[model samples]
Target: MIRGCGRLLTMRTAHRVETVRAAEAALMTRLPEGALMQRAAAGLAAACFSLLGKGRVYGARVVLLVGSGDNGGDALYAGARLARRGAGVTAVLLGDRAHEGGLAALRAAGGRVEADDPFAPLATADLVLDGITGIGGRGGLRPDAVPVARAARGSDAVVVAVDLPSGVDADTGEVTGEALRADVTVTFGTYKPGLLVDPARSYAGALRLVDIGLGDELPGVPDLEALQHQDVARLLPVPGAESDKYRRGVVGVVAGSARYPGAAVLAVEGALRGGAGAVRYVGGAADAVIAAHPETLVHPGPPDRAGRVQAWVVGPGLGDEPGVAEVLASDVPVLVDADGLRGLDPALVRARSAPTVLTPHAGEAAALLDATREEVEAGRLAAVRELAGRYGATVLLKGSTTLVCGAGAAGAVRVNPTGTGWLATAGSGDVLSGLAGSLLAAGLRPVDAASCAAYLHGLAARRASEGRGPVTAGEVAGTLGEAWRDVRAGE
Candidate 1:
């Protein structure tokens, strides 16, 4: 339950399991034998001490769920450090054989091993260390350890996981079976995909990185990255002194029908607040959009006739609109979202020379991929990558954890860490499409526009809600300027 201001705001880079192993091996060769494990143990112990509060380490009841290999060894060594500080530490071994050196160190530090009634100590425990599995463990917890994991969860102890929670896929972030949920996970070297991507990400409550000095050993391009406030600030467009409305950029909106005019209003709201100098509105909802935002330049014809825009945002609530094809034909960057995603031609998107962005929810993505919604949600990373490759466009897969993959699906996928549950309201995606389209018009690359838009959209939602209740799409749009200022302040 240790909270901090830096965790969510910092740029997080996650490497795959194979990459992590290679980095650890390279670093281990340079360091002395057992030195790496000692470093991990020291960091783990310090994190646990902080969680236990000042002057609370002594006489605290601590239980360690130890398993085989280095994961258990890290826990055992950390537990020994706590035991030496006068804490009542107990280890419940769940694997066939434990690390010998770690076991010896714990016994010497006056920490006792529990063979009988392991569940009894958990009832009164103040802290529980989950070392039953590491990043290598997959397909869920073993049958033998299921009961113990449940008991640990049922207890009032603040559970801390070593490396990562057991039974979760480290690379895919998929929890196939039963897994242990941790209040805090202390990882070494670098972040794993499981710590950032959902299903597995939800299980890892709060993440703390313990630097074991593996920076140079890792690869230059990470598997995944999360944008920080400073990163967003750097990407945001700043208007020059001589910049005019057209010089900044103009984003055209081809959205809404007679029935869903609010969608048009919301999209226009987002575009006006986005980095673009001006927002152009087309389609049947021009009256509604103009009534809400008088600053918009309205057009009564198709997007091509809407007079020169740098980018077009199409398909927010067009029930039976015939503008998707027209918008796709334009040379400017186009953002296809909501109704625009329905029956979108991959060939048309691929043939375009300019950049294209597809923003789809799980259902729309499932439709595009011809897969079930459950499949898309379960394997969001694979879904987004496959979609990007198929359409040759930058894809933004929106969910509890938003993911953005660059065109061709070749580089590191950017994961947005600022999203809150309150952003699930209707018309929010429309706002996001407008915002991202505005960035595209402002001359940002496809990936940069999409990721920066998501960062701002999610941040605005968080600000509007203030962690108290639900937030409307209009409120989120209204708060965009505040979020933009907040990001710039970090720089």
Candidate 2:
């Protein structure tokens, strides 16, 4: 784990081609075309051998699913290396043209090509290299190649993808059609967005980046970033000796109602656990909130009388309540979530002077954008950024991987790294709202607060699970302190 300043270091998708081309150019300048392929082959062979957990490659059966380009060539040469080590190697060509030089190398090393074999020694193979397509592939798996990929997937052998899992869009992180699910994906040069984001991210089971030395030419700025523990630790606010409760920053939460008081309790819990100096609750659920957390200052009134605070969290369990509009109209940085997302006027929000952060799940985001949930889900990044630009606010789209986008000229998007599928449980959004609001109150920018809070919240859920069973929203809030410690300690 690398520790650094509050800033996060991430590999963006836009710069990937530049990085690859620079490395390819450098290698071309110094080495012969065949020489670079040999080095890549050697690296692949070493990785596969290590993964086998056995010293001898003599009896191991290896299957290479070859494509048309350099990616397929790498696999072919690697197959040749395995063949020379006494491993039985078979190459299944999925393209019209196989790498001529690579095929010659494999034959010289005693590897066999079986292009039409639907079941080419895959079942008994120790490992399968999916060289079907690389970063440049589009649409879906070629119609003819789909069934063969299906056959390979049905096998018991561990699957490794070269560069990326075929059929996944490298730049946008979109999965077009039937994609190969790999046990591990060995990416070259730099990380692709598909390897980091969801949908496509789910296919790339585990990711390993092989340096190949392309760091120097990467762009200075990234379009998106994933925060590590050290990054969050530096961003977290620590109280000082001179800091009083007011000076430390006050978070005002306007949430819940007579019908749903639990949302208020959960939100307060999230705020208290988030390291805020003080929490101010103003809603119909004041009594319920006080019952859950005695430290919170509960005010059974409207948003106008909520008193002065650095930040506000509106919505959560706020069911048809009219106070949502008043809260949104406040001068402080505000976070809108759950029911508060309904009937929001984009123009009014855009006209506000203070920063606003909207945390919407798919359905709510759809309502805000006047689009269907399916559309929002399909184009999550575009939808969130569009919302941010429309409302002149920072938007945090929560799902498998939360996406944070800042509005205006200095806009930059960030993808959250800390999350587990378990955090999908109910009432979790309430907790997230409170946590983000607290960070906003603590004086961090909307982008920083939303991204950092989401990272910590997700980490807490994972920590609470401990590789066991289902975890509740309360359990997630309880684990926030430990999550904070873990991030600070670089765990």
Candidate 3:
């Protein structure tokens, strides 16, 4: 997720409460009493120092929201360091008690505690440190701290969250009630799952990880993994000197309908740009498909006689009675999206001998899970896992935070790191479906195809949007080749 030229970054994530606690305890035993906390404080102070720009912090106002835990202590110690350097540091304690040593350190460093009217100074403050709760915090922010959090947001001051944002679930990325959003989050040790997964990830803007000696303590296998560009480039199918139309892979597109011939064209457009050698078009919109792309191999009927293909992409705008049944009956890998997700039978999906991929947005996932869209969006990790397990397929839940989940307990939920808010445009998911299906046909596993497609699709959208602008599905599809080249070059 970090942007550095000529660099490939794969950020492994762990969100389990027990896992973090265990790693912390193991490291604590090897270090001095306050060594770890001091390291965190030093790192946090440096982050704030850099954020203050080239100007000195000497008269700048820095506010700390101290809670009852070590999170508060981290903030307080960091604030003390800032205070020692001449910053006007103040702590607003929310709980009945505060970290005793942290309070002493601040007092000795010339920082004072604000017992009343914390919001008064916050309006003119230069920075606000939210140490109200640690990563272990559950549910949301308490009622008493709500106003201060709101004031911090309202003010022009830069807000820095210590560890994970308070009220955001560290494991699930579920945000309930009030949350203290930060412009930059200075996380200690390793990246928490909440920092990578969305809804909560969006709260953690511009993440910066600080090494505090927890790398050795962390386990080998992480709960989550986000695919980087090099990782995807390795999985992309490359044509060889001996390769031909049948050798590389052929993707079959069974999309669009009488009502929406444009969707078929878009799907074919995505497939053509994907690693597939050629694309086979099926369904009633053959005339429109051929008109849009003469290169497409058009078939006028069901896919049963559509000739041989390596993979099938079904759904898109194919209406209520989407011919997903006939496509699913095929032996090759099948990617289901849009209307194809309707009336889907879990048993049929589970019974398939070939790999199955389900690409769904929040609404589609909610329908399959028999849950509300809000609930699904709130718990994307849970929803994707449940769908993968229930249907025995690889599930790619698309949104601001695109995630792919694989079947089996050992499967690591892959989060797509590259995406733009502008990608929420219409027909985007159809393009994603076709692209991922084409990858599946090109010999990548279900998980790899789904994740690689998401990564490239998102990258394509970002490239199509440039730094900032509105983008359409066709525009995004048109730029897939550029995105692919960038990924390969690690640009």
lDDT of 2 by residue, 310-403 (tens): 9999998989876777877888899989888888898878888899999999888898889998778767777788888888889999998688
Residues 256-369, model 3: lDDT tens digits: 988988888899999999888899998778888898799999987678888899999999999864579898898999999999998799999988888889998999999998
Which candidate leads in TM-score?
1
Ranking by TM-score: 1, 3, 2
Candidate 1 lDDT tens digits, 1-491: 11111322357899999999999999999999999999999999999999999999999999999999789999999999999999999999999999999999999999999999989999999999999988899899999999999999999999999999987899989889999999999999999998999889998989999999999999988999999987777778888778889988999999999999999999989899988989999888988998899999998877899899999999999878778899899999999999999999899999998999999999999999999999988888999999999999999999988999999898999999997899999999989999999999898889989999999999999899995789899999999999999998983
Cα misplacement distance, residue 285 of candidate 2 (Å): 0.2
What TM-score does candidate 1 get on C-alpha atoms?
Answer: 0.97
Location of the lowest summed lDDT over 10 successive residues in candidate 1? 1-10
True-structure lDDT of candidate 1: 0.92
lDDT of each: 0.92, 0.82, 0.88
What shift in Å separates residue 427 of candidate 3 from its native position after superposition?
1.2
Cα TM-score of candidate 3: 0.95
List candidate 3 stretches off by more than 4 Å. Answer: 1-9
Q: Which wins on TM-score, candidate 1 or candidate 2? A: 1
Give the C-alpha miss distance for residue 405 in model 2, angstroms.
1.8
